[model samples]
Target: MNDKTQDIAIVGGGLAGASLALLLSHHLPQLKITLIESFPLFNSDNEKSLPSYDDRSSALSLGSCRILQTLTIWSQLKPYLTAIEKVHVSDRGHPAGTLLDYRELDDISDEEALGYVVENRHLGQVLLSALAQQSNIDTISPATVAEVTPQADEAQLVIRQGDKQQRLAANLIVIADGAHSSLREKLGIAVEKSDYGQVAVIANITSSGYHDGVAYERFTDSGPMALLPLGDFNDEHRSALVWTVDSDREADVVAMSDEAFLQTIQQRFGNRLGFFTRVGKRHIYPLALYKAKEQIRRHIVLMGNAAHAMHPVAGQGFNLALRDCSALVDTLCDATVRGQSPGELDVLNHYLSRQDLDQEKTIGTSHLLTLLFSTAETLPAFARNTGLFGLNFLPGIKAWFARQAMGVAGNRSQIAQPASSTAAEKRIK
Candidate 1:
C-alpha cells in the first residue's frame, strides 16, 4: 500500500469520529485509519480549547455504557460519571407525573443504574487518551478536508493543514463532523432541517438538596427542561441543566443576572432539587432536527450528528449515534471475516439496512417527545398530562418506555449484545 493510502479516513475528531476510530482500531487492527479534525484535539494547559469538549454534559444510555465498556475506557470514565438511578418526569401545574426507576427493569441491576451523566471534557479526555494508545490509528489535528471525490473503488480526500496540503485515498470515508458539517455539504449531501422555534440554555447548577441520583425532566408552558444529576463538586450537590425556551426569549434569558436566572428557573422547575444555590457559565443554542438526505453511498458513510441531529428533549441524540457506530463496526468486521473490501457498497448497504429501523424509531420518538412536551396548546397539554398519568399506572408500557430511554428497546448491534444472544444473527439474516 502507498504511504498516502489508508483503509479508512475519518473526518472530524469530535466525540463521534474519535469513538469510531477507537472502535475500528480495536476490532480491525490490521486496517490503517486516519483521523482528521479542524480543531486542536488536546492541550494540557487548556482542556476546553475544543468546542465539543466544553462544559456541557452528555447523558449516556445504559446501552452506550455497555458499548464503551468493551473499549476498555469505562474504568477511566467511571470516576467522572454520575449514575442516573431514577428519572422524574412531570408537567408544571399538573398533578400527573411518572418516575422511571432502574429497579423496575428486569435485566438491569442497581449498580448498573438506568444510565449515566458525564461532562463532555472528561469524556473527551478519556476517548482521546485511548486514541493516543492505538498503534494503528493516525490523527491529524488542526486540519480540514478541503474536498472529497468518490472514485469507483475508493474515496479521495484533500486535507488542508495550515499552509500545506496533502492528498490521501481510502477505501472508506466516514463523516462524523457535527450537525453543521461543511464536508457533508461539500459532498453535495443535503440535510433536511426542522426548526423548533426554541433554544436550549445549558449550564451546570448547584442545589441545596441532594439529587440522590435522580434526573428531572420538567415540562413548562415555555418549553421542556431537564436537570440531569451530576457528581458533586466541592461537596456541593450539582446537576446539568438544559432549559428549552422560545427563541424570542433567548436573549433575555442569556442576559439575565445569575441570581435572576436562578430565581426564574426555581419558579419554572419548582422546589424539585430544593433551592438553586449556584450556576456555572451559560451556553445557548437553537434547537432543531436535522437529517441528511443520504447516510450511505458506496465508499462514503455519514455518522453521528452528521447523519441526524435531534432535539435534546429526550436526550437520545448521542445514544442513537453510538448505536449506529456499533452497527457499522459490526458490519465491517463481518465483511473483513468474509474477505470482503470495507468500502464495498453491498457491505455498506447491509450496515444501513440493519440500523435504519433503529434510527427511525429513535428519531421519531425524540421528535414526538419534543413536540408533545414543548407545546402548551389545550389539546396537546391535556394529552401530555394524560399520557404521563397513564404511564404511572401502566407497568408494561412504562417498562417499554424505560427501555427506550435506556436505549435497549429496539434491535441492537451484535457487538452491543451478549455473546450468546441470537437477536443480532436474526437481524443480520
Candidate 2:
C-alpha cells in the first residue's frame, strides 16, 4: 500500500464518468482526479438547445436517488424531479393491468416515491456544476483521448486539447466514454453486442388528465412503450414518453406529423392519461445490449455504457451505472486506506466482482422483458397477459418486481441504503 498522492483519470465526462468523479472527489478527498470529456459541458444557458440532451428523460431508481443525495446534488435535482408513485404494467388491448404501488410495499414509507423522473440535461447540469466546484477534480472538456499507455506502475493518457496535445499520468484509468467507447477499442477490449433491431423514440407530451404520479409500461404490437410522469408543462399534466419502434419503421415514425405521431401513440398507449394534447421534440436511439467482455485490466476499469449498455426497456441502464460508481468508490476508499494502489489489478478486480451479480440481474431482466413483450405471437401474447394478471394478484411476485424496479433488491449498497451520508463517512474512516 502506498500513501503517496495518486492521480486518477476518468475518460468520458458524461453522466457515468462525471458522477464517478464526483463520488471519488467526495469520498477520497486526497486523490487527484481528472475528468476528460469530448463534448462541451452542458450549462443553464445552452442546455435547452443541446442536441445530446434533446427531450431525453431518465428514471432515477430509489437507489440512484439515494446515491445522488449522498453526493449532495439531490437538492439541486429535486426541483426538476417528478415522483413516480405507481407503475401500471399491462399488455396493449388487454383487460387486466398490473399495479406496483409504492404504498403497497411494507418497508417503503408512505410519503416516499418509488422513483423519480428527470430530464437528462437537468441532471447533467447539476453534475457538471458540482464537478466544477470541486477543488480536487480537474475537468478537461472539449478534448479527446488520443492514446492510452498502461505501464507497470501507472497509465499514461495522450490527450488532445484544442490545438495542444498533452500527456497525463494516472494510477487508475476509468473508461466511461460510452457504449461505443473509442478508448475501449484503443485498449483492444472486446465487447459482446446484441442489437434488438428496435429504435426508442423519446419525447414529452402534455395530457388532458393528471398523471397522478403514475408511470405506464405498455407492451404493444409495435413494441414496448413507457410514459413516465413529469412535472406539469404550462399547467398541463406532462409525461415523458419512450416508444420503441421497429428499426425498419423508425424513419416513418419520426417523420410523421406531430398530430399523426400523437395519434399513433394514443392508439398504442391507450387513453390512460387522457388524450396527449401537445407533443415536444422527438429523439430516437437504436436499442442494443453491449457488454465489455473484460471490465477490468491491470490499471483500468470501465463504467456505464462503456462497461455494459442494455436496452432501455426497463430503464435500468443508468441506475446500474450509479451502483457501479458507489461500489468503485467504496473499493477505492478501502484501497487508499490500506495503502494499496487503487489501480492495482486486485483493487480493480474487487470492484468488478462486487458488480457482477447486479449487472447480470439488471441486464438479464431488461433483455428478457424486451423479448417477452415485443412479440405478437399468440403463445407469447397469451403468456404476457397471463403474467401481468398473475403478478397483479400475487403479492410476493409483485413485490419482487417492485423492489427490482426501484433498485432496492439484492445486496443493497451503502449508497442506496438509509443514512447514506453516515454510511459513506464510515466507509472512508
TM-score of each: 0.96, 0.94
CA lDDT, every model vs. true structure: 0.88, 0.85
Residue pairs in clash, model 1: none
- Model 2, span 222-332: residue lDDT tens: 999999999986788899999998999988987899999999999898888889898998988999999999998987888999999999989999999999999999888
Residue range 198-238, candidate 1, lDDT tens digits? 99999999999999999999999989999999998889999
Q: For candidate 2, what is the lDDT?
A: 0.85
- Number of the top TM-score candidate: 1
lDDT of 1 at 299: 88
Top model number, lDDT: 1
